[model samples]
Target: MKTIIRNVHKSFGDTKVLHDISLEIEDHEFVVLIGPSGCGKTTLLKIVAGFIPPTDGIVEMDNHVVATSSKSVPPNKRNLSMVFQNFALWPHYDVRKQLLFPLNHHRYISKEIRGSKKERIDEVLEMVGLSEYKHRYPHELSGGQKQRVALARAIAAQPGLMLMDEPLSSLDAHLKQEIRNEIKKISLNVKSSFLYVTHDQSEALSLADKIVVMNKGRIEQVGTPEEIYNFPENPFVARFVGKHNLLNGMWHDDVFVVDGVRWRKDNVSEAFKQKGMIPLRPDELKIVGRGFGNGSGAGLGDGFGGSVEGLPGVINSVYFQGNQYELNVDTKYGELKLFEPLGKWQVGDKVLVGQR
Candidate 1:
């Protein structure tokens, strides 16, 4: 389904939640709406799902208007299926019955699928790896298994579009990754366009063919995962999508000067330069050596007297991961974080921070 949302705006009484939102989801494309909570991501998804009408916009599916401000199509009338944040499985229904209900009674179920209901159920169950759990009730399943059932149920209808609202938010870290991979594979095998919503960056990055980043009821930017992560259009996207340290600085043409040090802004957006700030990812910085952080060579070099060519800061905190050390340092730019493989630094140690 090629869905288009144009001039979408939502409001409740005096508070406005969405502002002139517009985007497109291509057929069989996996588009993710990613933003923090209360940013209107779920609200937008509900609008597309026909749960709510937009206050002032039009929703078109394949060039036909399905929703407008005054009139809207019911969800069941649309060729789409939805998976909610919770499992939303019926307690009384076993897995097979759960999959059976949709095939027996959905408006959008194809006649071919309806005739071969049992085969369709088996195929979807195997795709989600829940073939053996067909007779199991919701109470008899693990959280991951329950989620798999939910996914299988959504896919069984064979809708042209699948809407998922944070389907992995309720799972453990390991299960989240496991189910995420399943979702990607299933999306491909089913040949259904996915309009998924999530606040998890990893899920959005790993799954989206295109990512729409929203903030304060407006779109900050729209791009692929690499474009959104490595080339944010604005400061909000930079800070929200990745672990970045926004350095307060001045831009002189291609040069960015911060705390008496100058760096080149290679391909950084003009939006950042206009705001007099630059976002440097944690990996973009390195701990060069120990220094006094006072712009003098008094206490510099490898605990010896030498000149330091980078910003000076004191280590504020240190966290040990299996492969690297996450260190927070207090520089004039503010507290910034950087990761290094060496565990030789401790809190309160003054060090020079340089760009990689």
Candidate 2:
């Protein structure tokens, strides 16, 4: 059930959308395509779903060329299912009928699965936590329930690959979090390859086994969730994938000099050094007590209690983020952003910004 996309490019009139996009989805792997709007993530998903053909390159499914520039095997023939942002369910059918349609009609459904359509529907409904809502129609279901039905229908066919295009975008924040957990569990239990598309960094980070970071019609980086979040390959990935403040610095061997303070470059990618920049995550920063000389060699500490030699900055704004406080500080170098647990910090408070 491995899918390979090779040199795929898409264009409309003279406007190019995707550029030499190449990716691979392994069996039972959850791969997420993530980028900002107009970054060609959706266009790439559409090409793989057979809704549109690539202008150049081929898509292979298990060694079989399913799509090429000249032609494409239609979506139905490709043995894959897609779930869209708008829960594309039939208005006339109840939840049970929605699941039964694919199980009885899909080409990929095996005889064993098709013969036991009633049991499969029950199993799928239970899997999506919609077992109690099987008798309800689209209008009778909430947005979350409607999406569960969509998910159930997609899986009822037992397709080898599932393509999802921002399926959780329309739901509210609380519902989004709830369904996201369900999606993760289902993706694992079903053992189906999932190629999901979304712009939300949290969803990508939480749901993906491998993340494909795309920007401006090109792939920025591809790695596991930990690798992509910690060791970004480029400036675009560093800024887009996580909450990082890019710092201008000079790398001297393994030590990085920024704002008159030298720090060791621990596990930072080489791209930062080449670009004369470093990415500092919020957790990597700390608020220090205002004392000591500006360029003293006092190393950064856990917080205001230890060493105080660091970049002098004034707190600009503070945001309460549940368990932590996100602070924006204005410094001589630039504005620095960092997070701290509930503290007595307020706007216009003078503090020294340091790295942990």
TM-score, one value per model: 0.95, 0.95
Clashing pairs for model 1 are none
All-Cα superposition RMSD per candidate: 1.9, 2.2
Please provide, for model 1 over 127-234, each residue's C-alpha lDDT reduced to its tens digit, 9 standing for 90 to 100.
999889999999999999999999888889888789999999999999999999999888888867899999999999999999999988899999999999998888
Error of 2 at 149 (Å): 0.7
Where model 2 places Cα greater than 4 Å from the true spot, the runs are: 291-307
Give the per-residue lDDT digits (tens) of candidate 2, residues 1-356.
89999999999999999999989999999999999999999999999999999999999997899999999999988879989899999999999998888777687878889788899999999999888998999999999999999999999888989999899999999999999999999998985799999999999999999999999999999999999999999889988987788878799887778766776657888889898888888788887665333343346553546654467777889999999999998876778889998988888887777777
Residue 90 CA error for candidate 2 (Å)? 1.0
Backbone clashes in each candidate structure, one number apiece?
0, 0
Tell me the lDDT of model 2 at 52: 97
